[model samples]
Target: MRSFLLLSGLFCSLLSFAQTDTLPVFPETPPLLEDVLQDAEEEVDFDFDTYYEPLEALREHPLDLNRADREQLQEIRLLNDLQIEAFLEYRATAGPLLALYELQVIPGFDLPTIRRLLPYVSLRSSLDDFHVPLPRMLSAGKNELYLRWSRTLESSRGFLLAGDTSVSGRFLGDPNKWYTRFKHSYENRLSYGFTAEKDAGEEFFRGSNPQGFDFYSAHLFARNLSRTVKAVALGDFTASFGQGLILYSGFGYGKSAATMEVKRSGRVLRPFTSVNEASFYRGAAATLAFGPLEATVLGSYRRRDGNVVVSTDTTETQDLPAITLSSILNSGLHRTPAEIADEGAFHQLTFGGCLRYSSDRFAFGLNGVLDRLDQPISRTPQPYNRFYFNGNQLWNGSLDYTYRLKNLLFFGETAVDPNGRLATLNGLLAGLDRKVDVSLLQRWYSHEFQSLNGFPFAETNGVNNEAGVYLGAEIRPASRWRLNAYYDLYRHPWLRFRTDAPSRGRDWLVRLTYYQKRKLEVYLQVRRESKEQNATDYFGPLDRLVAHQTLQARL
Candidate 1:
């Protein structure tokens, strides 16, 4: 990881010193982004591009604070609802902002928050939403192209025998990994881009991949094109509705050191520009606004890679055997013959819509989504997998609400599967003082509930068979010092993989940070987690669950 960071730093230095004036100069990567990447280093399928591309786009076309609406502000993801409400109220009473430093007067917008927003916002008011000519919108946009490649310097055994077809476990292609991206953006209104990638050991421009790259994604997104149409997306995209129970794709926020920023907030529709192959829809989606009410509808059809199981009957006379999917794979890798065999094993069709009404003090949303597959999915049955969804079709509907009363903001979502099982999440954010803010969240998801694309804040990877309460607080004790902490207590009501019975857990985290004027910054974080898992030393046929604890601290 250190070497990788050094290489990235060197590359950025070269770009920064280049003679080309057209190249955009990006600000330093935010600490929040670095923390997210470091936390997920253990995840084999994690892609850094999924999170970096949006910030890059924001730098290229910074948001106009005077003209950006509530939805656009929320997409920034740096401000909480309380802060947003405060900013909007301030703007309503004070007129358009004359200077960026005026944010210091807002109740919840502290110096730290203002500093974070400096890179992504501008005080100048841009063009009106209406009467924008198409030719100018296209010709005035910024165009960018990026190409990157990486390969291991050491000679591994597999790469040494690259062309040995008779040898087992030999690499089918070279060790080079390649990536390319091209984008055009017209300020904050329009964006279009395409991303292509080829993983190491994957054939390029030959054999399995004659198309040059293993994966390709492209999208065209426009915002505020008309009074009725707030946003529209064509090609690849992602959708997120209230609390992410019905539909959520792309990057997500979860439990982290930034305790107060836990809520899921973003635009209802966003263009897909990441290299992640399976997490986005590949069709079209649109959002329409009328007064205070808004409507969003989307439809998508795409191929999915899955582990296919063929019928074992030998007496069948047919040339091809009946096949069923055992599981879906999201690694987006096709380096080996076995991995290649699972490519595009099935096709999926998805359609969904959301209806929302928003005002100064209240908001409500109704979301519905349905997914259908060309082939049936039947996982190998196990005690832990009994409640998993299996079939050709699945549907879910949810209702989410948010209300603001003075200094407190309340939000929650309730969803139901076709079987009538329920999943719910609710939370509250309160500003007790100018320098103190706190948050509370609770969730209950039945074991029978299932979601394919939903990503929520929880201890477990999936949002089922769990109930928990989380309490978080942030405080500025002094001029340059801040304190953050959170505690979560959760329980799984049903059997999980490797566990024979119900289990419970608790997590605690505390972080202290100090920031000095433009010269020095430091932070210390300590975290402890205790959970139940099967005992490793048990000699009995059926292992017993035992408590396990782990502690970590970093500075």
Candidate 2:
């Protein structure tokens, strides 16, 4: 944890850079985004670049509300489905909005929600120029460049031992961290950029990284190319579909104060500008539209870091000793010989496609994906890992749907692995009245079910071996005060890492927020969670499971 905090401090230089235009380069993050970032920073698996791109882009080119669609509005990350639906319904009946304040009349658009939405949205005439020539678009596009450098004020243990060649675990590079990026983009139509980074104790222009930075990523994305072609991407990018059961890449929200915002929504293909190496794909993808039907296809091939184990025993199927992998490394740190050896040690190939049909009230889709690895994965046998994935090849297929009727909305996804294992998630959102809204979701995953790239709403970390139900509500008692609350109950039928036996858990949260628009904003939040875990006082041969509870309050 100390090392992670140091790395975050290293990024302080990143915020010191100045943009050419000097137009509020990066505004203060909204409350919702701020909360998500705080949670992501605590877990080192996420790349900060993923969150920065969208915010920067929106600041540079605000969305035109009159022309924005459902998906575009959701991209702001500040509005929930209930609000979006209400806004769309209001727009359909009231016609193109003439002013930003017109939103006050829309259902679910309270003062706080409006304040959060103000910066990223604008009221533009629908009759604005619909088409522009390629040359003009290229000449008018925006360009940005950023460079940052940082180093510790004093030498740490890693630096003291770096020069000792006899020490195998010593750092291999200097103590500085460097980052640089260049981006060019036009409105939302086209974007191309490249980012390079070198972490502390990593090689730079020598040793293992003779070419320069230890990691480099580039991408080219274009949308609304033609009437038939919706979007295209080359180089690096991410894909998210349905409710994120089978395939979802990039950052996603789990449990938050906005309880009804559990469903995942976004464009299928988005450009990858983050430094996180493991959560992106390098290749090409395209989305085509035909009337009410749309199709997306993609292919990716990349080398990944992994812990490789070479066996001494010979196998009957081959002349050489068998080679297997114990785990895939995602930290993106290579400061020692052991860490460097694990870098790009294995190859992965992924191919997938999705087909969807949509209307104003409902939508349906089918998704399929295949992943193959050059080396097989073999985990050390353990009672808890009996259901973990092994071998080299995997494939999954799923069906997802969404239907909106009056004030009620329904969404779900059901997926299956090659072995017939099942995983499913379903949810409902209802605007009970002008002052209240409620949500309910239920999920079930077989013990053998596994999703290597899925990040869905669940009690556990991943989307497997869990069954739970969630109920949440949001109430606007008055113009300046609002309340939010939720309760969740879950159980694990199989043994967990710390708990030696089947366990169950329950969690609940309540938050009250006060809003005065631009004047003042404050909130009080309380949460308590209880779950079964091994007891520390037990002296029996077998560990005893006991209920443990945690309580927290924040303002």
> Tens digit of lDDT per residue, candidate 2, span 428-456?
99999989999999999888987777778
Reference-based lDDT, residue 428, model 1: 95
Task: For residue 448, give model 1's deviation from the true position in Å.
Answer: 0.6
What are the Cα lDDT values of the candidates?
A: 0.82, 0.83
Q: Report the Cα lDDT for residue 166, model 2.
A: 90
Give RMSD to native, each candidate.
3.4, 3.5
Off by over 4 Å in 2: 1-20, 39-52, 58-60, 126-130, 133-139, 151-169, 315-317, 536-539
lDDT of 1 by residue, 259-348 (tens): 777778878898888878788998999999999999999999999999999986555476576789999898888877777889999999
Error of 2 at 129 (Å): 6.7
TM per prediction: 0.92, 0.92
Task: Pick out the ten consecutive residues of candidate 2 with the lowest summed lDDT.
Answer: 9-18
Q: Where does candidate 1 stray beyond 4 Å?
A: 2-21, 41-62, 154-170, 314-320
